[model samples]
Target: MAKVRLSAAAWGLSAVAAGTLVVGCSVSVNTGHAKPKILKDKLGDTVATRLAATTGQPKPDVTCPEDLVGEAGTTTRCTLTTGDGSTLGVTVTVTSVDGDNVNFHIKADETATPAAN
Candidate 1:
């Protein structure tokens, strides 16, 4: 996991960009077949990449508990851990699906949670 330091205001601004960030993931899906999903690592990497681009910061550490289901309205929670050990909650929601492409929205929490002692 990579960690990047960020000011509170920078986090806030990133949060705003997060709200409107839509990432499209390409994966093959067959109707009436097994369910499709974005793997945990892939999801985390995508989020980190987008966040880094938005904030002009190094790619931060992000972890997802489970794979994100590739279905409209499906969602999963991922965490972004900063260099100082603070964390921000990120919600990834599937907004729409088209053929083999999955489009989702990423929204970060308005504030960070201080590290636990």
Candidate 2:
């Protein structure tokens, strides 16, 4: 049998190298257009459908620009046409842009009031 040995220093270096490599390989989703995509996604599917059905609002008209982008702590405006022929403004704010994952906050625009069915 062959035996191999590594020094403490060597093991420490290897550990550090592995950690660095992992950190480097970690990826994050870009805020570019991610903001809009998230908004549209939630709205076009669950959020809009639920809101419209419950609120007696017309099918929501989700409007988001393909070019809108943002960074953590940044916000962008989005709009949806409501049932009452009124625009329901919303803000898509980026909370985190981390490794293939993005965290955000979506809410009605500060000046807009949400209508309850």
Candidate 2 residue lDDT tens string, 65-106 = 432243576666556554443454545556666653555554
Q: What is the overall TM-score of model 1 with all chains considered together?
A: 0.77
Candidate achieving the largest lDDT: 1
Least accurate 10 contiguous residues by lDDT in model 1: 24-33
Whole-structure CA lDDT of model 2: 0.43
My TM-score estimates for the predictions, one after another, are: 0.77, 0.43
Distance from true location, Cα of 43 in model 2, Å: 7.9
After superposition, candidate 1 runs with Cα above 4 Å error: 1-4, 7-13, 20-34
Q: Please, what are the lDDT tens digits per residue for candidate 1 over residues 1-117?
A: 744477545665676666555343322333332566788898898887777776667777889999877789999999988766788888888877776466777778877887788
lDDT of 1 at 16: 61
Q: List the residue pairs that clash in candidate 2.
A: 27-99, 28-99, 28-100, 29-100, 58-83
Q: Whole-model lDDT, candidate 1?
A: 0.73
